[model samples]
Target chain A: MSVITREEVAHLARLSRLALADEELDHFAAQLDQIVGAVARVAEVATADIPPSSHALPLENVFRPDEVRPSLTPDQALSGAPAVEDDRFRVPRILGEEA
Target chain B: MSLIHESAAELGRLMAAGEVSAVEVAQAHLDRIAEVEPKVHAFLHVDPEAVLVQARAVDERRAAGEELGPLAGVPIAHKDVFTTVDMPTTAGSKILEGWRPPYDATVTRRLREAGLVILGKTNLDEFAMGSSTENSAYGPTHNPWDLSRIPGGSSGGASASVAAYQAPLSTGTDTGGSIRQPAAVTGIVGMKPTYGGSSRYGLIAFASSLDTPGPFARTVLDAALLHEAFSGHDPMDSTSIAKPVPPVVEAARQADVAGLRVGVVKEFGGEGYQPGVLARFREAVDLLESLGAKVVEVSCPSFEYALPAYYLIAPSECSSNLARFDAMRYGLRVGDDGTRSAEEVMALTRAAGFGPEVKRRIMLGTYALSSGYYDAYYGSAQKVRTLIARDFDAAFHQVDVLVSPTTPTTAFPIGERADDPMAMYLADLCTIPSNLAGNAAISVPCGLADEDGLPVGLQIMAPVLGDDRCYRVGAAVEKAFESRWGGPLLKEAPAL
Candidate 1:
């Protein structure tokens, strides 16, 4: 069985928001399939009992006093924005036609 | 004075003693960059005026009697991945081509506070996803050793800057051998400090858990000095460890491996390793024994799967981390001419912006983490992470540190592995295990490979906070090899 098919790669591209070209779809399908086949070997050694390790160090929620501190000015915050209006980031419409 | 050739420590001392002004030292390096940058293409951005400005400030501070750090007046190259408020901070991705960040990364801030002159931002593999810098959207940085070969990467430019004498020191981040592999092929010292030992506050994330900023220098003590300057806890990054920076500089100065138990990873060498790389690695191990260190071979069976597990884990994290570049905020936005929706523009921009390798990994992570295959791919890879850590724990129980060839081969021809992802991935084989376990590892130039006449590196790995052990062992190897060869291995590099 193929690890990932061409159609599946197209679906993944959509899910990942990458508008790949037709040739890129074909190229990536073959490469991703090969990589998947090689990397799937981890399952062989990962017995059911072994707990997964998401990160190497322990992660904990940190807290600080609610006092405010100095921060980037509005000009600095929006400096890198592609578009800005009213000192905020501007983006294309987010809603659907119905909304 | 040969300012460009002097180590960071020497540069600092000379400036402190008023023997050399920071501007003069900076000018020498700027001149060197002008002479070499055209051939090597190590830097993504270099403003000679800006460097001299920073250098002059350092000189003035010293004149005012401020007690600056040991590396106070040294010139250092910053990796492009770190955000710099004053300069364009593109992570070698066209998506961020001309973007200027609003604030500095903690590493960048620390470098400035320490008075290290910012030489410029160096090139890297785009979003730090590739083993060789060929994936850099700008262009590949050619190796100084051979213009036809890769300099090793994602931190290729960092290693090459020091290797080519463009800069005495540079900074790099190692997620999976980005620092060590490049340093290995380039004949320099690169250390990946323990995962949280260095701050990740404003480092553009690749794999948040794995990305670690570290120092690259021509000598072990120089690397140690840079390491201590930028490392320690940062509250901004929750993952940052709250502890004193390890005594790595002192360990490098100590340079003793007497009675230390060194373990040669049994699974790393042979079969797939290049003959010359393996030969130099063995000689370094033997030299360690000769220096009064006890050497033994230890088995880490799970290490065989580190590369595969790493492929899955890093990409999975990258998929999440890179999601922040959705074409809405800072960076190259496209297709938003009122007709297309934000979603369409994001898709169009990402496709137009990311290189083939970055796109491939994002899609691979999407596939790995998708509903049906999650257990088989990403989940299993996480399990293997535990197994690999267990392997390290077992080995550490028997040895003070582990040693291996930093990589499987020397600098390969640039185009050789560009089309072959697996072949390119093999370049990071031996250095990935340490990343997976969140341990400290350093790559010090051992010698040149006989076959290709290119540099090779011996990797030294220690447990989580035992960052000092890597410096101790690396410094010993550096001292021994320097004496045996009558100079550093980099001295053997053909002059550009």
Candidate 2:
């Protein structure tokens, strides 16, 4: 069986929020299938008894004292925004019909 | 020798002794960059005036009798992936083109605090996804050894900067083998300190679990100097280790492997490895034995699965990490001419912004992380990660450090593997397990490959916090090889 079908790649692109072209969908489907097939070997040793390691180091919740520190000013925070209005990020319509 | 060609340590010593001013050192490197950058394309941005201002400040501080760090006056190139307030931090992607970060990456902040002059930001693969740097939306950085070949990436520009004498020191991040592979091909020293040894607070994320910032330099001691300067506990980074940074500088200066047990990984050699690379690696191992170090061949069977597991896990993490690049916030925004919804704009922007490899990985990650398929792909890859770490744990029990060829071959030509993703990934074949296990590893040039006349790297791997061991062994092998070759391996590189 194909590891990833063209339709599945399209679905993945949607979930990934990428508007891939039709040809990209075809090309990536073939490539992702080969890649996915090769990486499938991980399942051979991934038995139920073996535990998964999410990170290399054991981490703990790092807490800081409830104190205000120097932070980016509104100008600095919005400096890189593609569109800014009133010191806030301006985006297109989020719900309902397009504006 | 040209001032630009001197090591960071030598330059700093000269500056401290008043033999050369920080401005002079910075100008020498800037002049070299001007002469060679058109051919190497190593830097994405260079502002000579800004750099000289920093250098002048260092000179003034020294004149005022202010105590300076050991590397106070050295010039360094930072990989563009590290955000910089002064320079546009593109991370080699058009999506972030011209985006000047409001704050500096911890590495950048620390380098500045240490009085190192920031020459400019070097190029890299887009979001650090590819091996050859062809994935860089800007352009590929040509290897200094041969302009037609790659410098090995995604830290290609970092290695090339040091290799081409544009900078004596540079910083690079290794997720897969970005640092080590680039350093190997460019004939320099690159060390990936233990994961979390350095802060990643402002580094543009690729695979957070595997991302490690490190140093690149012309020599082991210089690499250690840069490593120590930027590494330590940072409360801002939740994963930052709470302990003090390992004493790599002292270890590099010690440069002794006497009585140390060195294990040669059995799986790293044989099929698919270039004969010349193996030849140099064997000679390095032999030299270690001659230096009073005992050498033994150790097996790590699970290593064969590291590449596959890495491909899955890295992309899976990247999918989640890269989601922040929505057109709503920073970076490139497209197709939002008041006709599309927020979702449509985000989709259009991502598709237009990301390079092919970046998109490919994102899709691959989304597929792996999607429900129903997550268990077989991402979950299994995590399990294999544990196995790989266990392999390292087992190997460390028998040896002080493990040694192997850094990559399967020397630098291939620029376009040889660009079209082939799997072929490109093989460049990290020997370096990935160390990242997966979050161990400290360093790549030092051993010798030139007999066939290609390109540099081959001998990788030194140590336990998690045993970063110093890597420097010790790397320095020993580097000294031994320099003596045998009559100078540094980079001396043999053809002049650009």
Candidate 3:
């Protein structure tokens, strides 16, 4: 089993969407190396013939009836909001790219 | 009243008879919280007033001579991950700290309908990521058995509260070993009903496929009653099993090991496990044999790969599941002067909101799912998952149940393995496969580890939807060992 490296850790952080500090990077790097080393054993025995599984049971088209039902009013929905504006639950602009 | 220590069944009987008020039961738990919470650190948020209000409503209903479910008037706390309208569902993470959900999770709703008094929300590892409660951003919950040692998590606080007598029953969600491991350390009964047995409508996601919500309590029957209340389909969760929850309380009382076939997984019972754990486990198996259960060695050869496969699959899903925490949604927001972009705001919020363990998982998950690596990492991990499931399927045909040590050893000292992530990950080795297979499992206090005198749990697992069987076998074995020991293990633990 190979140890995880700093670049791999950095790449993972980018994928995860969090910016880590310089101090936290080295600590996580070593930690990840150990964890990955332990978990890497699966690759040895996982053969090509086996189809990967995601869920234990197969479920198909499990949807609820689409009917309007009483839901929390907008005020109730936004009751826990730290900030709001124009009766809408205010959030920072979610889609950062100009649309 | 001292009935705070009474079983959920006893409380229900008292409430139905109008001999003890629901409010009285709720108040006793609230008082217990005030008395023991400092040392146990079990609750994240508790509303004494709200608990009393809910209790009084149950009392009023009973005073009017209305029908009630088995858990009515029984006080219970939920793990912080389960959403509750009356309190913030933090999931022990700063990302959603102080955020109250718009609606209660279906499990929480079911408990409310059953008139189970809502005591509070308990602590857990942030995002339920770690085996030990040490990963909790709030603070590690001290095992009631030995205050300096960790209460195994991510359901640490749930088990701790019950063990500490802060509440008689609590809810816990196990992904890997969260529920069972904590139960082992705290000397309580925790059962992860078959995956999808309990609805996940409002439980903040943590590896969605593996997550299971279950019950924690002082006895098998108590856990069975609370589990019965929540184990059924909810329109909100597609994965929820459509089957009605089997009568677990009846199973617990009628539990018999006579002629039962139990498989001792060869992969689990071996070295790397502490000697004390081995000794206690051997004795537990012997006791099972004495009770007339046919115990034999069985191997799920693929389990050797379970830990690795789980790490990959769990992180991949967690990365996707946790994306909802971007500051733009409903939680803490930071950064962004209008001149700066929203992207910057999300970065800052996430960085500030999440702790090290959460960040590590998100990063690892993201890496596993990234385009170039997806086929190599997540894809291969999923394949391993298939093999693990097949292994379980093969083993079950030969045995009615599988048994193993809940953890490699008993509770470890705080900070002992926190810095060593691999050692910490190994803590869930025996517990991870059940989640992968969606099997029902329970960890009941079997005996104390000979070395530390700390508790060792005997984990019993059964086929999916065979939840009542776990209780039947577990209750029988628990009685066999508990009777010999004279009482529950925690009763003998040095007072905190």
Best by DockQ: 2
lDDT of 3 by residue, B156-216 (tens): 9999999988888999999998999999888889998888888989999999999999999
Q: What is the TM-score of chain A in candidate 1?
A: 0.92
Candidate achieving higher DockQ, 1 or 3: 1
Clashing residue pairs in candidate 2 (N, C-alpha, C atoms within 3 angstroms): none
* CA displacement after TM-score superposition, residue B356 of candidate 3 (Å): 0.2
Winner by DockQ between candidate 2 and candidate 1 = 2
Q: Show model 1 residue runs off by greater than 4 Å.
A: none
List candidate 2 stretches off by more than 4 Å: none
Clashing pairs in 3: none
Query: Which candidate achieves the best lDDT against the true structure?
Result: 2
TM-score of each: 0.99, 0.99, 0.97
Output the chain A TM-score of model 3: 0.77
Candidate ordering by lDDT (highest first): 2, 1, 3
Kindly list the per-residue Cα lDDT of model 1 for residues A2-65, writing each as its tens digit: 8689899999999999988898888998888889989999989989999999998777888889
Which regions of candidate 3 deviate over 4 angstroms?
A1-4, A89-99
iRMSD, per candidate, in listed order: 0.9, 0.7, 2.0
